[model samples]
Target chain A: MKFSIQKDRFAQSVQDVLKAISSRTTIPILTGIKIDVTEEGIKLTGSDSDISIESFIPQEEEGKILAEIEQPGSIVLNARFFNEIVKKLPLDRIEIEVMNSFQTVIRSGQSEFNLNGLDPEEYPHLPQIEEREVFKMPTDLLKTIIRQTVFAVSASETRPILTGVNWRMEDGRLVCIATDSHRLAMRKAAVETDSDAEYNVVIPGKSLNELSKILDDTKEPVEIVITDSQVLFRAKHLLFYSRLLEGNYPDTSRLIPTESKTKLELNTKEFLQAIDRASLLAREERNNVVKLSVIDQDTIEISSNSPEIGKVTEQVKSRSVEGDELRISFSAKYMMDALKALDGTEINVQFTGAMKPFIIRPEQDDSTLQLILPVRTY
Target chain B: MKFSIQKDRFAQSVQDVLKAISSRTTIPILTGIKIDVTEEGIKLTGSDSDISIESFIPQEEEGKILAEIEQPGSIVLNARFFNEIVKKLPLDRIEIEVMNSFQTVIRSGQSEFNLNGLDPEEYPHLPQIEEREVFKMPTDLLKTIIRQTVFAVSASETRPILTGVNWRMEDGRLVCIATDSHRLAMRKAAVETDSDAEYNVVIPGKSLNELSKILDDTKEPVEIVITDSQVLFRAKHLLFYSRLLEGNYPDTSRLIPTESKTKLELNTKEFLQAIDRASLLAREERNNVVKLSVIDQDTIEISSNSPEIGKVTEQVKSRSVEGDELRISFSAKYMMDALKALDGTEINVQFTGAMKPFIIRPEQDDSTLQLILPVRTY
Candidate 1:
């Protein structure tokens, strides 16, 4: 391949593809990025078996020639070294050319790098997924959905299926849910699509996180295609593909509590800060548990104790509280994470009992919900 | 002890003292910060045996009441927990009170903490230094001197004395030197003293780093006192004590070459960037070595080759180059560090030969010098 491209735009494309490359992969070529040059543009591909990312840089855009193609060819270069050299090149235009025996030359300003490139034919081909149905959603809304639920996925590999977030689309809405057995986070959004196809697939939480970082936060629409074993997200100049989890996701609809004996409304920021302070001591313990005690109809107390260190108690006033006086202990980290992911100031929390899971949601919206199981501390 | 202090100011003071407190100390009591309350103010002290820091919060400053002292007493609380609690308290004013049986109550807004405080009587006393002589210099200058030399100190403990920076004062100027056997950094400054005292001492590089972080960047003067076994730095409302290294420092004056075969002047930034780019490949090697070869009177080439990976060559233009043609190899990291610490853009480099040490300094300044030993490439 012989072409000169704008330094900044090419570096960005390289970075996007690099997100999918892993140096520890068993396939040596998988650790490198494949470059294909054609009449249209230059395409960069990187994969680590689980996820594959492809970013394209066109020859010209908006009346400006971003790249000049001298020949159409392909080569695979080490991703780590290519990225480092491209980022530190001393000029705005970078020229990369392939020679006999696959030796690649990269020149920019006064700097020149000669790298031993591998044959692009040795790289494994990406999974083939015929697009039968496509769903379109706003990029910002998709990012929000991932942010709200992905953190609840189990980080352990004991049950590999729980490390993914289940995306269920039916009728005219999409629901994303993630649970780690101890807690659950669910977010609902109204999505627009031209088909009646429904998807109940689970995408790895790690993949969703990487996709979120690469997607721009704008109202621009992104095309999503789901197949039997793979899902692809298509943006303006990028294609992201992630493998779906093999096993079925556990049904979590019955896990959410339907009714509560105690209910309270509190300011989210104030309550989060109170739990944060309470966790300062509780964090020393294994579970990082904090207790909540209902003192009266209008006030409650949050406290944590570590015998060797100290004990902290904080009183937070609720807009309104009603029910039997109760005391419950739960993971302070889970509560703080849930609160931070929420968007509103006021939140309503409902408890079934001291031992049962409690549900928290925005006061005026029922779309986003968080549930945490109480720890047995009595 | 009972007092209410402004949260922000108190938190800043607590942070400063916590720098000296390490959880890995030999003495258990050293992990706790001692608090002493007097009619005038409140003092917080933290120590790790090698270094101790005391920060005071006065009752009033600039006609504003910062702290209101109701009782005078002393107590020591776990530094880790105290700092965490003070940082997250939800009010402008925080009240700390010592109750019976060494129990302390810290209250802010609606939050209260009950901590198990240790007896202050067991806290070790700071080293007492007689007020024989004191030298003063701008806090910014002190910070600069530490920044220029500390990174060159040997991190290995084999030669324990090399882990400290030697400071020698004679005439009206103070010189600081640090080396790791391969390279050396020296900085000199004119300082004013209240008494006629010429001294030479070695202060632990770690302590200077900590002191630099605690001192503000303003040009306000800071008082420095050197004793037989300890050095004391007194800033407004703060006292920092550091124990000196316990061995004689080796003289490094003769290591710097006085005569050179080749001399060159170059733009500091251009050469540094070239070296940085060249090091991208060299960094994979054991010594991170990069080579510089003079191409002509006004041009030079910086290059690095890794047989298995690749090679990079960059040509950089120099302002002037004279004397014998030469080629030398050195650690890219050391060269980068020296260039970053320099003040001006134009720098003069004097090379003795391909194997001997080279000297680098600002174009017109002789107060700061850097000597780097070259590696044998053939």
Candidate 2:
């Protein structure tokens, strides 16, 4: 197979697929990216067992020549070295040739690189998923939802299912939830989908993170297809597939309290800074715990103490406070994550009691919420 | 100690001193920063045996109130936590007060931090250097010299002296030389010093790197004071002292050949990029070796090969090539470091033979030189 393509265009496509190439050497062939030349265009695929990413470069794009195939063939080359070579090639155009012996030669400007290539047949095939349950959503909204909730997923492998984010669709809305038993984050948005179709798939949080990075910030709509086990998201020339966890996600609705005894509204940035400062002292303690106490109608106290490192206390003013005054202590890292996920300027935090889990949400909206279980401190 | 200092001034000083505090907590007191308050000013010091950094905030500067001290005393506090607290304090001015039993209270805005402090007597005292041998040079020049040569220092602890840079003065010319036995980097500049007094010292490379970072890029000159075994640099309100390594630094002059049979001049940036690209293919190999061969008076070939990973060959147009054609291989990392040290449009490389050591210098200036030994490739 022989082809010539613009250096910049090829480099970007290579980079997108290279992200999925396996870094683990258990499967030696998986370390390489498979490239296929077809009559329509060129397709590149990279995959580990958990996730796979594929990108296509059409023969012509916007009346500009992208690639021309002399013969339809396939080959696999080391993903990392190939990407580096393409990026550093000093020319506007790049020429690639694959010999009968699976030897690949890449040339640009005055430089030529000859790399040992493996037969594409030796590479694993992309999972076959039917598009019968296809749905569409804006890329920007999906990226935001992923970022807002992915951070709360459990990093430990004790409960494998908790390591994945739960995505469910009902009515005409899409909901994403992630929880590590300690803290939970949830986001919901409207999307155009089959009214009769519903999805309750759990995708690994790490895989979702990698997918979010590859998704460009564009207004273009992404087509998502779900099969019995795997999920596929397609946007423009890129195709992303993630393996779903085969287990039932925990019922998280019961974990979120339905009632509250006290509620306070404060600017998100102000509360974040206060907690950040309080965290300085708390970080020296064993659990990295910081305490928040509602002193009066308009005053809130944030404090942390370590026997050896001393203590810090800060007073932050709030717009309003009601119900019984309460004090709660929780991990500073968890609080920071919950605050970062919040988008609005003001946030409403509700407390059931000093020991019960409290919920935080945008002051004006209830579509997104974060819940943190306080730690008991003497 | 009781004082009020501008938050910005205190924060910057804390950060400067924090650089000298090592993360290893073998010495508990060494992990703490010493703060001394006087009617004249406030001085903060951090030390880890090998190096010490002290930054002072005067009571007043240019009619502005930098620090106001009501009591004169000193205390030591955990440097890491203290720096973080000062940086995040939410006030323009910070008030610090020391109470009985070594308790320190720092207040800013509506936030207050009560920190446990250690007795200042437990802190190591800064060595007093005689004022006999002193010189001054621009902070920028000192940073430049350190940056240009520090990368060549040996990182291994086997040959401890090679981990330091040999600094010497001859005929009012200050020269800094560093070599790990495989490669050498030298930087020379003229400084104001006593013509009759010549000095030589080996300063630890790691210490020099930290000193370079702390040196602000200003026109102000830094005073250099040499003690029997310690070198101190005073700049503005900051005092930095580093213990010199004992024993003799190897004579590197003999390693740098004075004559050559072949020489080539090439664009610095272009050569660096070519070497960077060639290294990609050689990275899989143990040595990361890249070969350079003079093809003619105006051309040179750069190439690398691995039996399993294939090969890369690139021809770079040389500005001028003289003498006999030659081919030599060396570590790509070494060549890149040399090229980075010499900031010039064109760099001249001299090669005595294919197996001998070579020297690289810029065509416009002779203040800096880099040398590398060839690797015998089968």
Candidate 3:
């Protein structure tokens, strides 16, 4: 491959693809990034079996020439070193040339680099998924959905299916859910699709985490194509593919309590801060558990006690409190994560009892809900 | 003990002292910070055997009450948890009360914490250093000197004395030197001493690093007292004491050459960037070696070749070049460190020969100099 391209453009593309390249890959070739030059543009691909990322730089962008092709060829370079060199190159334009035996030379300004390139033919081929069920949504909305639910996914691999976020589409509405048995998060949004056929898939939480980082905050649309075993997210000049988990996701709709004997509405920031301070002492203990007890109609006490370290109690004013008095204990980390994901100034928390799971939702909307199972404390 | 202090002032004092409290210490009481409430003010001390730091919060400053002492007493609280609690407390004023059996209750606004405190009598006493020979220098200057020389200290424990920075004073001038045998950094400054006595001491590099972080960038003078076993630094409201390394420091004066066969003056930033880029490829090799050769009277080439990965060559322009043409190879990391230590826009590099150590000094002054030994490349 012989082509000259703008250094900044190439560096950005290389960085985007690098997210999928892991250093500990079992397949040696997976550690390398494949670079293919065609008549239209140049494509870079990086994969780690679980996820594959491809970024393309067109020959011309906005009437300005970004790259000029001298010959069409392909080669694989060590992703780690290649990305480092590209980022540190001290020039605007970089020229890359491939010689016999796949010896690649990169030149920019007065600096030049010659790297040993592997045969691109040994690289794994991108899985082909027929575009039968493709849906489009604003990039901002997709990013928000991923952020709101992905953190609640089970980090433990005991239940492999729970390590992914389950996505279900029905009647043009899409719902995403993630739960670790002790805590659950769900978000619902509307998407545009040509077919009314319903579908369900579980995408590894790690894939969603990486995808969210690469997604920009622009209002542009992103096309998602789902198949039985793979999924693809397509944006401008970028293609992200992730393998689908091969198990049925557990039904979580029945886990959230529909009615509660006690309800409280409080300022999100104030409640989060109180829990955060209480966690300072609770974190030293085994379970990182914090307790909340209703003091009066308008006040609640958040506290945690460690036998050896210390005990902390914080009183936060609630906007409104109703129903019976109650005290409950739960993981401070789970509560903080749930509060952070909710949008708005106020949050409504519902409790069925001290021992049962409770639900938390933004006071302004009901499209998202977080449920946490309370810990039994003597 | 009972006192109400401004939260921000108390938090800053706690943070400053906590740096000396290490969790791995064998002395159990050393993990706690000693808090002594006196009629005049409150003092907080934290120690880990090798170093001790104390910060004082005066009762009143400029007619403003920073703290009000209700009674006089002392106790020790766990440094790790106390610092975290103080930082996250949600109030402007904090009240700390030591109850029966050293149970400390800290109250701020609607929040309260009761922590287990250790007996103040069990905490190790701070070493007393007689004010026999005290010197004064600008805090900013002291911080700069430490930063410019401390990084060259040997990290390997093979020669324990090399892990410290040697401080020597003679004829009203103070010199600090640090070397790992392969590279050396030296900085000199003038200070006012109470007597014309010469002294030398080696302070651990880790202690200096922590002390430098707490020093403010002000023109106010800092008093330093040196003794046979320990050195003490006194600032406005802070006292830092560090134990001296007990060994003789090697003389490094003979290592620097008096004359050079080749002399080059170049912009410090440009030359550093070129070396940084060259190191990108060289770092993959075993030794991280980069070669520099004089191409002409006013230009030089910086390059690195990794037989398995690639080769990179960069040509950087020089302001002036004199003496014989030479090519030398050295550790890119050492060269980068030496270049970063220089303080001016331009730097003067002097090389005795291809195989001898080179000296790099700021073009504007001789207050600081860095010496790097070249690697013998085959």
Q: Highest DockQ: which candidate? A: 1
In candidate 1, which residue pairs clash? none
Q: Judged by DockQ relative to the true structure, which candidate is superior, 1 or 3?
A: 1
Native A-B contacts reproduced, model 3: 0.95
Q: Which stretches of candidate 3 lie over 4 Å from their true place?
A: none
Identify the leading candidate in terms of TM-score: 1
Model 2, position B82, has a per-residue lDDT of: 91
Models sorted by DockQ, best on top:
1, 2, 3
Model 1 misplaced stretches (Cα beyond 4 Å): none
Residue A109 in candidate 1, Cα distance off native in Å? 0.9
Deviation of model 2 at A345, angstroms: 1.1
User: For candidate 3, lDDT tens digit of each residue in B254-334?
Assistant: 998999999999999889988988888888564889999999989999999888887888898999999999999999999
Candidate 2 has an interface RMSD (Å) of: 0.8
lDDT of 1 at B264: 90
DockQ per model, Cα = 0.91, 0.88, 0.83
Point out the worst 10-residue segment of candidate 3 chain B by lDDT. B277-286
